[model samples]
Target: MAKLLVVGAGFAGAVHARELANAGHQVDVIDKRDHIAGNCFDYVHDCGVRIHRYGPHLFHTSNDRVVGWLSQFTGWLPYEHQVVALLDDGRKVPLPVNLDTINAVFGTRLETADDAMSYLASVALPRSPVISAEDHLYSTIGKELTDLFFRPYTKKMWQLDLSEMDAAVVRRLQIRTDRDPRYFRSDTFQALPTDGYTRAFERILDHDRISVRLTTSFSQDDMAGYDACFNSMPIDEFYEFDLGELPYRSIRFHVSHHLAATAEGLATINYTDAGPYTRETWWHALPGHRVHETSNVLRTIEEPCCYRENSLERYYPIKDRDLMYQSLYERYAARAATDDQMFFIGRCGTYQYLDMHQVINQSLVHVSKWIARS
Candidate 1:
């Protein structure tokens, strides 16, 4: 059996560890944070409510294979999220800015769907060869809608002007013309682990062949003993930022509590305006088997802060020519190529945004490669 060292206990690292160990290989995993699940970590709140430590990870994917693999660890709970956007005038409307939402939001000239769609199409800027986030919205929906729905909310969310951000950042999440209120694009239905995200991770981290080192960091010397290393930590940190440390964005959550017989219809509501907060969620808002009582144990919270963090923990990659992560990546790419045995995985490892399923799929894919040699 091969010896594998996986740095970071997030989805990517955990997946790698599980895959290698399941095949009778020795796998050692470490995370400086002392947690099994990195960004998706969750715990019981003061009121005995299970809450996400790093905001919320509503697991949504169109990938069936990813869903099937995770089924081994946790049972699925069908949940399709509904997003509510707080307009500039303090009105709440459905997301994707659909025809119904458009009519409700504008509450004026855009009364009919045809009129709204036609207006949007007419105002859309001419297509551009190279598109930024600003250009994506302007080209697709028009400048007015982009300014209203995207510009201010984006400034509040990322702390940088949309004009400065990368086009890929806003290119993905789209506005569907249909009335599907479900926010996530999961294959059939969106699902969160029944017990909790943490419990599911515990199973993955507890494999007999997989040794876990929590609240600890991994180094080159630590990696030397292993036959191969799959690092899920930041790429820059792996290289000690030879070019420069890249900037990342993170949010701070302000939580509040109230004893209520019931909660609002939605599990989450988006406050796009400049209200010292970006989004709010009630733990028991989503109608299903909740981990806590609806009354006296619900958490209502606000997340704010729009700038890139100085620390190494990357929330969102600052994709711009200023940092030129691509250029720096080329340097990292060169180093990684030389190692031959070390493989970088995960958001920070590959320096790309990944959904929950994407991380798991990454590990599953790695298993195939790991098993091939045996």
Candidate 2:
């Protein structure tokens, strides 16, 4: 069996370490943070509420294999995620801009789904090769909807104007036709672990063959002990950013608790027009779960300025032609590939956004490839 080092105790690294160790390989897992789960970290807050330390990570994947694998760790909790947008006029509309949202916001009833689609198509900009998020909304959805929803939210999410980014980003979220409030197809039947996500990681990392070290950093000097290393932390930070640091966006949570029976009538609420925050979520809003009446609300604010530091825990990678993120990523990816048996995994390692289920799926795929190579 090969000796392996897995960096970062997030889903990607944890899964990799567990798989390798179970296969009789000596595995060492390390994380700079004092925890196993990365951004999916959750624990009881100061007020005794079950708080998602980073943000709400609703585990939803249509992949049956992923579901089967996760089922081995924890029982499933059925939940349907519903999000709404708060308007200036005290109106709350379903998110993803459904038919209900358009009817309520416009105050003019469109008779049918076809009618709404026709209205949108009529107002849409003439065929253009490409546009920015600002351009797509301004040219099609009109100023009212664009300004009220897309503009401010984009700024809060990326700390950049809608015009600064590609139109595809906004297009992916907008829907002018009549439809149900479910945002994505994969989330039709959402699933959350009954015991919380961290417990699953703790159990997975419990194998004697795998040694976990929290609040620890891995050094190149330790490279001698392992025949292979899986680096799941940021690609830039792993190499000390020899090719220059990549840009990223960060988040700030503005949480407060009040003795209440239920939340503010939203699983997630978007304050799109303007603010330090764009979205707010309550984890207890999910169905088939017992919520504590005395628990506090967990609200999050997107702070674009939190990503200035080179080692500030990069969450969202900045993607733009001018940013040259791919160019810089290539430098580190090339290094990892050429450096003997070392392998890069996960979003930070591969420089791409991936869901928790995706991270696990990717790790499983990597294990198969490793086995074949061996």
Candidate 3:
């Protein structure tokens, strides 16, 4: 059996380690953080509320393979995430610009899906070839709604104007004619683990053939001992940034405790004003997170900043209309290709804004191919 090393105890590394170990390979997993689950890490607070250390992570995916695989470690709790955008006029409207949201915003008492579609079309500024996020938003919802909902949020989130960013950045969000208030509409499976995320990670990495080390950092020199390495470290850091730095946006979270039963009625609230803060999440609002005996609430507010400014804690990789960062990532990926033993996986390694299911799917595919080749 081959000895393999998996860096970063996130989904990518945990999936690889588990799969390899099941195949009779000896796997060692290491994470710089003291715990597993990466950004999905959560723990119960003193007041009995479960707090997601990073931000709120809602698991929603259409891939059956992903759902089937993760089900082995933990049972599922059905949770459809909902978000409301807090407008400047102190009005909360459903996000993704749905039928209800449109009526509420413009005081148009439209009823059917066709009515909503007609309304949007009347206001939309058609752009033949949309290249930037501003263009996409304008073409879909027009300048008024775009400025009211997206422009300021995008500015705070990416620290860049909408016109400067790629269209793909905003394309993930859907503008629905139906009054579907759920954040993720297309996903077949939208739920959280029955237990906490940390417990699920514990079960995933509990194989006899696999061992994990927490509060440990991975170095290039450590690669000499293992036959193969599945690394989730930042690709630029792995290469020591020889080709220069790739830009990433990070969040500085400020969590506060309240003696109330709930903060807002919704689980998440997006700020539409030109403030430093972007969004806030109410921990107790989520299913499987509320404690019956406790009357306290934990709210986390997010402020976006550069990864460098946030002590190198990278969350979202910045993608611009110019594609400069993508080109830089390609250079690093080319260098990674030369090392046959080293494989880069996860958001930081691939330099893409990936969801939890996408990361798991990628690791599953990669490990299967690697095992077959071996």
Candidate 4:
């Protein structure tokens, strides 16, 4: 059996470790944080409600393989996420500008999908080539809607103008003309872990061949005993920013245990304009949790900020059109390519904005191939 070191005990590292251990490999997983689930970590609040420590992670994926794999660890809780946007006009409407949102925001009697389509056609401005996020949104939704809905939100999230970012960053969002208020409807599996993400991680990592070290820092010297290293740390940090540090946006969650049930009807509400924070999430609304009568509910307001090296934890990676940063990442990637035994696999490792399922899928694919070769 080969000895392997997996860094960052999140989805990528855990999945790789589990898969490797199952294949009769000795795997050691280390995390800088005290917890195992990384950003998907959740803890039961004193109030009895389970709170997602780093924002709400709603798991919904079209991949059956991913669904099947994760199902082995935890049972599913049916949860189709719904989000609302608090506009500048003090109006709350469904996000992604759906049929009800159009009626609520514009005060129009649009009943059918055809009416919604007609309205969008009337307002949406046609752009020749949509290269940036600004161009993509403006071309699809028009000037007014873009300014009200997307412009301020995008600025707050990434701290950059939409024109400065690649279109792929913005293209991930879906704009619907139907009455579907759910945030993600296209995914076939829409649910959360019945126990919580942390418990799910515990189940996955409870293998005899796997050893976990929490709050641990690793250096090049630690890689000596291991046959291979799977890194989920930031690529720039691994190289010690020899090239300029890549830009990322970090978030701070202001959590409050409410004495009463949450007033916010939806799971999350986005403050589109005139707010220090980007959005607020109510935890009680999500599936799979027992809230005792004495404990009340838990809610959080998410504030996005420019990433500080030592002060805060990096949450979201900024996808921009900066040639210098791109070139720097390419240099690191080239180094990884040269080292066949080292693998960079995850959101931070790959340095792209990815959802939970995408990360799981990548780990499964790459680790399977890696095992086959070994």
Leading candidate by lDDT = 3
Model 1 misplaced regions, further than 4 Å = 108-115, 122-132, 166-173, 261-263, 287-289, 298-312, 321-323
lDDT of 1 by residue, 209-303 (tens): 88888888877788666888889888888788877876667677667776656556567888766555777887766533355554654655655
Return model 2's CA RMSD, one decimal: 2.2
Q: Across residues 85-107, which tens digit of lDDT does each residue of candidate 2 receive?
A: 98888778988887888788778
- Which stretches of model 4 miss by more than 4 angstroms? 127-132, 166-168, 309-312
| Backbone N/Cα/C clashes per model | 1, 0, 0, 0
Candidate 3 Cα lDDT to native:
0.91
lDDT of each: 0.75, 0.76, 0.91, 0.85
Better of 1 and 4 by lDDT: 4
TM values, all candidates: 0.89, 0.92, 0.96, 0.94
Best by the TM-score measure: 3
TM-score of 2: 0.92
What tens-digit string does per-residue lDDT give for candidate 3 at 128-147?
79988989989988988899
What is the C-alpha lDDT profile of model 4 across 263-303, one tens digit per residue? 55567998888466889988877776555545478789988
Model 1 score (lDDT):
0.75
Q: RMSD to native for every prediction?
A: 2.8, 2.2, 1.5, 1.9
Sorted by lDDT, highest first, which candidate order results?
3, 4, 2, 1
